[model samples]
Target: MFDPDEIRGMLISAAQQRMALTYSEVLHALGHRFTRPLMRQLCKVLDAIDEDGRAAGEPGLAVLVVRQSDGLPGQGWFVARSGSHADLPLDWEGTEARRYVEARQGEAFDYWATR
Candidate 1:
């Protein structure tokens, strides 16, 4: 059974490796089956990080992006921090960030496809 801290740690490790994981990828990494409740719990962990960042007046430890994928329910990208870097703007609306995230997503897709 995976706890929230374990999930969070996995996410951070992925980020350190410079990989942007989707909900499915995260579950796969943890050897868990996909389920609605599990997805919700993962989102809650991301949200908690966001809330903590807001309360502490800092940037979030991760960023979540909602993306459309036909076969996946609640498809999105979760990117965690790699290291010391500039914090995203507190008022971040994701318009500018999406470009980078999408590019990375494409790279991830290409990588797995080739493997």
Candidate 2:
């Protein structure tokens, strides 16, 4: 079974490196290939990570895991956003979404760098 904490660590490393990993890259790190089922499972873990981050006043770590096509999180990620991120645009493939993701990713990258 995939472990959420382990994936979280991977995301932390990416954040510190100030780089985004494609969904396939994330799964590959775990010795798996991209599949809808596995991707969904990863998304669930990402949601949990963001939920925990929210409680801790940290930026969303899932922002570091994105689609290679547009360098943005999948639609599932936008759908899962809540709390302070509830105001995100409904359109995921546009400039608004890009800026929102960049800012969130920057926060994680900057915050992780300080640790």
Best by TM-score: 2
Q: What does candidate 1's lDDT look like per residue over 17-108, in tens digits?
A: 54555676766677877676877777767667655645865433344323225211232223333233354222223544555444544543
* Candidate 1 ranges with C-alpha deviation above 4 Å: 53-58, 64-97, 100-115
Q: 5-101 in candidate 2: lDDT tens per residue?
A: 9999999999999999999999999999999999999999898998898899888899899998989999988877743566788788799999989
The lDDT, on a scale of 0 to 1, for candidate 1 is 0.50
Q: What TM-score do all the candidates reach, one by one? A: 0.50, 0.94
Residue 20 displacement (Å), model 2? 0.5
Pairs clashing in candidate 1? none
Count backbone overlaps in model 2: 0
Q: What RMSD, rounded to one decimal, does every model reach?
A: 8.8, 1.3
Error of 2 at 64 (Å): 0.7
Q: Point out the worst 10-residue segment of candidate 1 by lDDT.
A: 70-79
lDDT at 36 for candidate 2? Answer: 91
